[model samples]
Target chain A: MRPSSAERASSGSFELFAWLFMRISGVILLGMAVFHLFYMHFVFGVERMNFNTIGARWQNPLWRVFDFFLLAFALFHGFNGLRVVLDDYLSQRPGWRVLAKTLVFVLVVGLMSIGGYVIFTFPAAANLAAVP
Target chain B: MKAHFKIKRFNPEKDREPHWEEYELEVEPTERVLDALQTIKWEQDGTLTLRRSCAHGICGSDAMVINGKNRLACKTLIKDLGSHITVEPLRGLPVIKDLIIDFTDFFAKYRSIKPYFINDEPPPDVERRQSPRQRARFDDTTKCILCGICTTACPVFWADSRYLGPAAIVQAHRFLFDSRDQGAEERLPVLSAHGGVWKCRTVFNCTDACPQGIDVTGAIAEVKKLLLFRKL
Candidate 1:
């Protein structure tokens, strides 16, 4: 392998983007989380958060989009933090690292699909009850 | 006592690829890993080649991959390593032959950090006086003896040989915190360049690999913190 210092520094945008993502998304997630907590706890109050209120809010696609971004960002931040551990320990074993990464990818895909389906198809309960 | 050693060997002049050779040997409980290698080279086989200087761990010349960890052969007791030992050249650099590795890239990175005391002041009759507290600032880093174990064991350096590895950061820390040195400001941007302190993933592999027990990771963190606050 060509061991030039100049080449590798320029070839590392993936790592650069990952580093920037953590810091920027952390700031964004903090604001979003604070706004969410205020809306849930102070503005609406805990007692008012019944299924009716949540279901009414879920009727808006904007709310779904908001929750989607929150889930995506939070998951990315937490998983990228876990990547530090994997990079340290698992990289020593190439085969194990590959398996670990594949499992993590599958888990993220499954969780995102399930969460998106639940948020978008809330009214599917009505169709289930009338099917019989 | 007896221990099994599996050493990675490659003779570039004769062999096309590297391979491992296993040897069973008798040893004393207090014998260092360097003594074990000496036995192998003197009695078992003369073709084995490795580097060792002080044989007491002070010279830092005998650092190698032992049991998948970077350590000084003269410091590691055979008893502490258990009955099995896997010896190999330090990773991340090209191996020259047997257990010796080419340290050109490692030393180049160290040089990039300017691992020397630098001052532009005119000399007085006496030496540059340093307070006890001022000397303590970079004390942990001063113990480094230019061993490439930390740099070679680094997985980031293994992935991209270009990245200035942890040893370079420790050297930078030494000069960066020196009260008599007038090069901290100059060294700051040099370290902050393309493959600077930002590349550290904080795996702490460097900290783990240091034979001198220096907190290499902590020094790198302090450097990264300087990037924001610009303090000593």
Candidate 2:
């Protein structure tokens, strides 16, 4: 028998979108992550990444947006992959699967919110004296 | 050459759990594992049990774990497997007896894909026709023999039985890519469902396990691509 409308609605195209997001976000993440590390480590210099440097970079909204997307895509891509892992390992254990998935969901949301807030709302200008 | 055969055995009536039984046999290097098994059953132990038909590997009835790999016993040459050979039933399925697994779920998954032609426009003067290119698109998946090796070899299917498994996706690909098959609309939803193509992790065990060299994992990726872009 076909599933009811409500039941079908729950599973509708979410996995498809999730699967696509992994591939797309994976590519985006690859470029963003490599550029991030290269820019920070080589051009910007790891030693120069003090609070004042970050404060200066965040003065530009584009940097904040880039950081936000970096955080979001990495989190979604990673947690969705984790969800697949949970589905694989905990399949025989229903209660644990639900609890673990819920925990991962909470972590993704909580971390995204925290990371987004930090990226967008951190003090735009750091007191130069505080760096030392 | 003298070979040591270690077979996993279980008797539901007498044994609570499966155990290993070993036999020593002299055999030619060119002889297949099936020959070694026949010698063991015929000369050493009559109770040794296995399923085989068309003993040349086309029937796909004798898929088992030979030397820790999924292979057709009839096709695996004893020379390839070292002196110590271990034969076990295909993993992730209930072993009905020694070297025989229950294929009820495996075949059911195959049938769930609607593995037949489904064009409904009906009655070309003779039969539906297709160009060579179109026929070649799905020719790789046409070699599937419904052997449980590919499905049982899949880690996803081993972990979750609900996952349609690689064999099912390959079967679906056989029809879904057919230019004459109207079943894509029917099969795509089943392939993209929760435990459908999405469950494939692309570990490539199915491709490695396939006796027919069906490119099982590649077929699954094709199905996923079709579902994603809705293009050929």
Candidate 3:
């Protein structure tokens, strides 16, 4: 009924979604990361890991899609975590905190764009180094 | 048994900063820390000051740092703390005197949460009754005594004063879950704001610090869930 209460009510759901995103993305990242690690490091082995080996795997398209999701989730999750840390540490400085968060947002967008492009568009054809 | 107490004392009129004073007294293991303090005030140092009433855990006025943990001086027995005990005022609050901190900000935060029943309907001739199960919904949070221990114990509260703090959230939980209360819509927004429930990092210090054994972290989590889903 009061002005303060009304203002608070009109506040966006950004914090709510951010909190939810952390938990959801964390669970997803954990599952995808563990699978990728085990499959790549244990099953595929580090000895034979070269550009051709990745090329052969990405040729299937499933791994490309899987790796893309992994890249996006990991970046978002890790940066969001850094955002929280920034929030905690820079709480005293409102202007600097806003600047830090904006920079982080730009950095995440840039990293995601580059990573996504590589995962989706990298050549799957055998090139200079074939594992065979 | 002999008990040695190291109490943090400060007098703005005389001292520039808080200093620890040690007192040695013969005490029984079953005797409470409040008993030792009383003895010190009565027999040893009449200037020793602390806030206490009821001489039991019910009042929650005796909440202070007992050996690095938030606890009621009345509830803490000499046996548990052994012969040596360290006492200090609750952290993150301005101390007015020895073992007494300013509670102005603390109570302001609590009041902001709007702790109390809010129901506007034609009253029944009998009473606004609730099922036992309905009452059980907010049973844990009903025990809050506004002790300020949970809030003071919270690291988030210590780091940032803007946070609503754990005690306030627990109070909000009490009314929010009540079947009769219609204040959730109002309370949820206040909590979802910048310094609201989202600031809780799930640290269990509030739960650990509650003298009434209320699951403070659990209550906050429940409020977060309620805000997310607006149900249960």
CA lDDT scores, all candidates in order: 0.81, 0.87, 0.88
Candidate 2 per-residue lDDT over residues A55-84, each given as its tens digit = 888888999999999999999999999999
Residues B1-232, candidate 3, lDDT per residue (tens digit)?
Answer: 9899999999989999899999999999999999999999999999999999998789889999999999999998899989999999999888999999998888787878789898888789998899999999999999999899999999887877778899889999999999989887777777888678998998899998899999999999999998889621
Off by over 4 Å in 3: A1-11, A126-132
Candidate 2 CAPRI assessment class: acceptable
Which candidate ranks first by lDDT, i.e. highest? 3
Error of 2 at B144 (Å): 1.1
**TM-score leader:** 2
Residue-level lDDT of model 1, residues A1-132, one tens digit each, is: 222467445533445456668988999999999999999999989998976677767767888889988888888887776665565556458688768877887787788788878777776333443433
Runs in model 2 with CA error above 4 Å? A1-9, A126-132
Model 2 chain A is weakest, by summed lDDT over 10 consecutive residues, at A1-10
- The Cα error of candidate 3 at residue A44, in Å, is 1.0
lDDT for residue B69 in candidate 2, whole number 0-100: 95
Which pairs clash in model 2? none
- Residue pairs with colliding backbones in model 1 are none
